[model samples]
Target: MKTCLPFFLTISLLIPAPASSAFYQWTDAKGVVHMTDDAHKVPKQYKGKATRIEVKEPARLPEAAPPEPGPAADLAAPAAGRGEASVPGGHDETWWRAQFGELRSELKTLQAARSQKEQKLVELRRRRAIFQRSRDRAAINEAEAQASADDARIGDLLNRIAALDLAASKAGVPAEWRQ
Candidate 1:
């Protein structure tokens, strides 16, 4: 028994261990590709199309330098341009705050314009319905045309409002300022 122990140990050390997991790939009914470790998890219909996939481990990236200690460390570092200012656009905090205020104002103005246009559209639609009930073709046509124009205007205002809101958010405006 003692003589056989060393030989068994040597054989075990010489053999390579089997991989613990394998990847399988398949396409679903919606034509989306998927990968998983268990073949049984795949749908019955897709099993026939499933293919074994060999996954290679990704290479590790080099370690990054330690971050600088400051209140602005959590935020993204300023990009290169203009001066050595710390803010994103090479502007000071006061400048950014003023920009945020302007964006909020613009957003409010656009929203008000959109609201007015929407109200006009609703009124025009009501007038069109009344003309239809009275069988007045000319009146109905006029109201419909006005409504269509108002709809286009309202869509434009909404888009502008969305753009302003996005700008304000990117400027890091406070939520209370948005209101």
Candidate 2:
């Protein structure tokens, strides 16, 4: 019995373990339900409804590429007759200036939009107050909806402005220019 036990143990150790896989379930727009093991197999229309039944193996990321030669290489090989200050990352001084100008213009436009949205919100609030005083529920509701929409627009504008500022900083724009 002892001899048989060791052999059985060795056989069990030699046998390959079962591979783990994932499954997903989803409902389609037409109210049809589907199940799949592969994420790629799930229908595009039903992607939002997909629920994973099993944990999927984490995808392996590709190895990072080696760094390219820097400003030294650019210095070694003079650009033919291009009278521009070229940076290491292929962005010349002119490009940076242009990008800064564009970003500033966009920032100005978004600021103007935010100002308009704020004004609209103020008007909506005034109207809402008037409607409330006059006991008009429908008008008040409409004003409230408009105010909410304006608020959302203002929020979006603010977020965009913040992102633009971050980008400007990363682009090496002068602090004064970014402001």
Candidate 3:
């Protein structure tokens, strides 16, 4: 505990010091600028002689390029296939469309499942509130039990969504479905 006290004090000091103090800078005869804690330290001859130094900020630089994909990308690299390709059938670009269609179908199913779970949770909560208002022992007990079950179901759905999120990430799909 004693060892932690000093660490805590040091961290407390590191909390942003309010901008209360003013800074003063001046150049000497040799044209070398110097800064001091006290203005009086500046020699009388050089004092009030140098121009008031206005702070000129450095120019903003352009943003850096994102780092190139490394080992991970190499390991999970997609096949060297073109964006859209002609299937053996020589019909419309059916193969490429099929992949997107499959993803959309899965997404739709997940959304419906999530919506149903949410609606059930809402109904459970409403019934629980109604039971609580009734002030009957049996009603309260039943409502509380049902609420617990609903909570467990909600947790299960949340875990399922999490697993789906990992799958979507691996499949290079966006997070919209999970949300």
The TM-score between candidate 1 and the true structure equals 0.31
List model 1 lDDT by residue over 92-123, tens digit each.
44444444455456545644554455455556
Superior candidate under lDDT, 2 versus 3: 2
The full ranking of all candidates by TM-score, starting with the best, is 2, 1, 3
Task: Return the TM-score for each candidate structure.
Answer: 0.31, 0.33, 0.27
The C-alpha lDDT values of all candidates are 0.51, 0.51, 0.45
Instruction: List runs of model 3 lying over 4 Å from the truth.
Output: 1-135, 176-179
Query: Model 3 over residues 44-98: C-alpha lDDT tens digits?
Result: 8866542222122222332332112223333333333434352222212232234
Instruction: Report backbone clashes per prediction.
Output: 0, 0, 0
Please provide, for model 2 over 45-129, each residue's C-alpha lDDT reduced to its tens digit, 9 standing for 90 to 100: 7664564443323333223321223333443333324554643223444443444455456545644554455455566667767
Note the residue pairs that clash in candidate 1. none
Candidate 1 achieves a global lDDT of 0.51
Q: Residue 56 of candidate 2: its Cα lDDT?
A: 27
Model 2 C-alpha RMSD vs. true structure (Å) is: 20.4
